[model samples]
Target: MTANRTALVVRGGWEGHRPVEATDRFLPFLRENGFQVRVAETTEVYADADALATTDLIVQCVSMGEIVPEELEGLRAAVEAGTGLAGWHGGIVDSFRASSDYLQLVGGVFAAHPAVPADEAPAPGEEYFREHVIEITEAGRRHPITADLDDFTLRTEQYWVLTDLLNDVLATTTHPAEPGRPWRRPHESPAVWTREWGAGRVFVATPGHDPDVLDHPSVRTIIERGMLWAARGSG
Candidate 1:
């Protein structure tokens, strides 16, 4: 089939997250879905106006990379003018931390990934992988990306995010307030959500911590659908 869309995949940053492998897992799926996928290893791609303008979707997999002012502004402008942005885990929300403007555009930030509580802590090397339930919201059930998807559980990093009201939340995960913690009660965090940036769409899911997690059937489906859902002209 002739490709009808362009997906720019910008992947790099912390190797522990395995950005290259993580994004690579989805490249075939994107192509199968009619996207002419282009891979980039740096955030510098965001600074090229012509490239950004022609692109229909961006699948970012960079974790904690520095994006200078010009690059960030170019990205911001493209999204505002109809270039879609979609990503998961630290690739989207945890990156470019020093840029407040970038945080505001994405509508959320990776505040923390608290380890499993002591009472239920796992083996010595697996302390940080907290098992948690991801509940799909009513809005999610009706949304194309997550429709008919059941509530699922994950045993990877459970992200604790800080988000705003402007987002249309699709799924959520909760952090039980352990006795010794600062908060008094359980804190609910958005596991998946979407945002409108002027003429563009933004989709984010906090579940994918690595390639294996992204390969989870439900996770893979949601992310694939989300990339399309975020692209320009999604029905």
Candidate 2:
């Protein structure tokens, strides 16, 4: 059995994403997998270096929240010292928009999600969001987090994110051109990816908009394996 592994879950932000509900779904999974789970509803925990020193993995869910400089530094230091950081959707990438340091560590930015034209757009969370397939990349098929997983389709908010080559993209989705938008051509974005920062690993998947999506078999499996793959001393 894995010995005394600590899983720190920091979650809270926009209620639209149901941070509490989403993270709760995985709490048991973490415990079942031999994690000593601790829950914090704020980013202030990131500022505690000593606390982070013992952490095996961090599951963050602060969607579009603000993070101070010292907190970001301490978090980076902990990760660089071998603590794993893993998260999904706006909870990770779209967080702390004001902190580019966080962006550099995570290696992706939340750009925009394509919506239907102004005139035809329905109330939020309706048909405006597209149903697209998530295609696993060659690299993903070989990665522990996504190995043996086939491409699947889900209807939720499909994120059109901005990413750099520093990310090892595991899955991708195409954004069809919206006639009235700034861009008129179809473009692709990374749906799932991982990055190695210093001595640590960071994993992100862009599929969890609603709590239900977090329960999707494919989404849940990827995230579960991802958290393990990013942990310190993990194979």
Q: Which candidate comes out best when scored by lDDT? A: 1
lDDT of the candidates, in the order given? 0.92, 0.90
User: What ranges in model 2 sit over 4 Å off?
Assistant: 1-3, 117-124
Report the lDDT tens digits of candidate 1 across residue range 166-218: 99999999999887888899999999999999999999999888877998989
Residue pairs in collision within model 2: none
Question: Which pairs of residues collide in model 1?
Answer: none
Query: Per-residue CA lDDT of candidate 2, range 145-171, in tens?
Result: 999999999878889888889999999
**Every model: Cα RMSD to truth:** 1.1, 1.6
Each model's TM-score?
0.97, 0.95
